[model samples]
Target: MTILFDQCNENLAAGNAIKLFADYKVDVLIGPTTNIPALPVFILATYYNVPLITWGMTSSAVLDDSPRFPTAGILSVGSKRYTIYVQ
Candidate 1:
């Protein structure tokens, strides 16, 4: 398995990173750490029909497999996804 890394810099450069990954015909994406940046990756993954596994972010929406991101799942350690965020 090959690993690839991109510096999204707070979702600002996520689109470019996704494009780069697609151009390389990558099979899957590992993470973006935060949901803000991973959001675009989620959509792009669906556009390219690639699977995206995001870590650290607590977004329950990724588990829904919606049309925007059908093959996406969140790998979060926090429980806010199932509960309320106090902060």
Candidate 2:
């Protein structure tokens, strides 16, 4: 397996994600590593049919939706866990 990294400003994540998919042609994608950036990247990954693995500070509950993000797997605690804790 091969891993490639791209460092993108949060605002540039979606566009950079396209480059990773269309240009680099990555099979599996890992991280925007934070919630805001990860949101758009998750949508794009679904469109491209690529599996996504998120880590670090990416704790959005939305990322855990299997129907919405069938190809995604989170390596950290999603916000849903926090919701359960709070309740």
Candidate 3:
């Protein structure tokens, strides 16, 4: 499905967007749709316990499940598992 996220100062806009998706009961967040803007939504997803698919996030840090980022995925490519919210 297509959802619109407005273009604005990302720090404010993207942070507020968490509520918009939550209101719609969105099952998964596909992207901020780009690499850079994805972080704010990633943070909010962690906070809201919403599953985030960082299909664009190239940061290897997210793969670490060291208890530090308990909400991040542990899988790499070739895994059929999709994004899931970790608690």
In terms of TM-score, the best-performing candidate is 2
User: What does each candidate score in C-alpha RMSD?
Assistant: 4.2, 2.3, 7.7
How far is 29's C-alpha from truth in model 1 (Å)? 0.6
Tens-digit per-residue lDDT, 1-87, candidate 2: 444443545558888788888988998888878888888888999999999998998898888798999998899988898889889
Order of candidate numbers by TM-score, starting with the best:
2, 1, 3
Q: Sorted on lDDT, highest at the top, how do the candidates line up?
A: 2, 1, 3
Q: Report lDDT (CA) for all predictions.
A: 0.63, 0.84, 0.52
Q: What is the TM-score of each candidate against the true structure?
A: 0.64, 0.83, 0.52
TM-score-wise, the better of 1 and 3 is 1
Residue pairs that clash (backbone atoms under 3 angstroms), model 2: none
Pitting candidate 1 against candidate 2, the one with the higher TM-score is 2
**What clash pairs does model 3 have?**
none
Instruction: Provide the global lDDT of candidate 1 against the true structure.
Output: 0.63
